[model samples]
Target: MTTTYDPTHPRYDNEGDMRDELLRVYDLCHGCRLCFNLCPSFPSLFEAIDAHDGDVEALSVAEQDKVVDECYQCKLCYVKCPYVPPHEWELDFPRLMLRNTAVRRKHDGLRAKLTDQALGRTDLVGTLSTMVAPLANAVTQTPGSLPRRVMEKVTGIAAERMLPPYARQRFSTWFKKRVTPTLTRRQGSVTVFPTCLVEYQNP
Candidate 1:
């Protein structure tokens, strides 16, 4: 079934405000293509925006999922933008992209599926790596294989990409081996958020 967002659709409480803002940013696109030079996804994004109209789904559920997979979650585009609007203004393109991701998640529920199955269960991933790591490496490294070729075609991750070898010991394991006493901070407590990448990626 082909489902599309409609202006009168009851699912959209915010109407097309998000979509309009995104399109507005695209309208402001100077055609300088600064973001294009930063990441592979940007080039695709540039093309999408160049052609996208009010009715098109340039950043829909399926399309956004593809973007999430293809993009390496790099902030290079954000840094390279010449006219990146501040949050106080309503013209932040990066912020718009992040909001688009959230809307996709809220509307389509793909983010939960991806995260719960692939991202949330680190322990399960670690367990699977014991078997899949070698096979993944071989398939990717092999010159002519269905798995290697198919993986490359579907994911855009290069078959010959030099993936890091799985560490023999996990961080917690290494941390447990240390005999040094833990030091307590005498001053203010600090919260180290691992969400920088997440924020940047979606944004």
Candidate 2:
């Protein structure tokens, strides 16, 4: 069986529909501990349901939120799950976690919604930070810095968590400057697309 994903499907729009699907997927995952070590999200979900006597519905929304929050979209579970869609089980743990997070954000408070929006716009943040890379790097490195303290208080990011430093030059800029023109025409052209981590944090 081939798995299909449709972004514009009604299930994505209907909160009740998404919630039912989420519960269904969670129930299936509860029975299969195959992905227990793939990521933190699975253990958190399993522990919560086990605490409620294997009753997923008995877990509160906040408990569910905890499970979703633990998932950082590592996609390791997708690679490990034998029941991934096309299989009769149709379990897609990472997508389920993403859907769960979307639903949660829809009902989240203003502060949470704002913080998530900011975090998700990595391109915008990277560009702005790169413009002031020196100051931004200094701020991130300074222990107990005022900006760091303020960020922690406002966004709930732990003060001790070392933030990624901005690059003095953006990745695109560096890549463009470093690329040398070939004297002879190449047989094939290549394009490179860097992820947010490579573009900003590791550039």
Candidate 3:
């Protein structure tokens, strides 16, 4: 079959259809095992199936969710897969996990769905946090702080996780002020895309 991905496709509209597609991909991945060590998701999937005598159907919903959650969209499996695209066994592991996540978000309760939405807006969060960076940095860094504990409870982020501290001055400000190197020899023009980390947290 010629494989394609469309998030709005009718197949993904029904939870059962999505689950079936996930199970089909899981069975194929279990048989190949080429991406066993690439990411946590692959190993988790393989282990669950192996425990159930190589039967994907034997794995519980919770077990399947855990496997999907372990995949952080690294896409390494897709890059390494010999059976992607034009191949008869067209497996897009990262996209599959993403589709599963979409289904999860759609069915999640209000708080969880909001949390996921907030997490997705990294730029907005970065900008807002950087505005009061010192206070934000202190609260995030202090393991047992009351604010940290409260944030953990509300956001489901671990209180002890060492989050990157935001800079008082944004990267664009610093970059614009810095003196560029004057080249004596002819050189090609260079461009930089300061990612979110460089723009806010690190810079």
- Best candidate according to lDDT: 3
Worst 10-residue stretch by lDDT in candidate 1?
A: 194-203
* TM-score between candidate 2 and the true structure: 0.68
The full ranking of all candidates by lDDT, starting with the best, is 3, 2, 1
Per-residue alpha-carbon lDDT of model 2 for 1-203, expressed as tens digits?
12223446655745666666767778888998888987888899899999999998887877877888888889988898888868887888788777767666777787686677668789998988889989888877765778878876776666677888898787788888996866665577688989887898787
**Candidate that scores best on TM-score:** 3
RMSD to the true structure for each prediction, in A, is 9.4, 5.1, 3.3
Least well predicted 10-residue stretch by lDDT in candidate 2: 1-10
Across 60-126, the per-residue lDDT of candidate 1 in tens digits comes to 6454345334556566666766665454333444445555565655665543555445545656655
TM-score of each: 0.45, 0.68, 0.79
TM-score of decoy 1: 0.45
Local lDDT at 149 for model 3 = 81
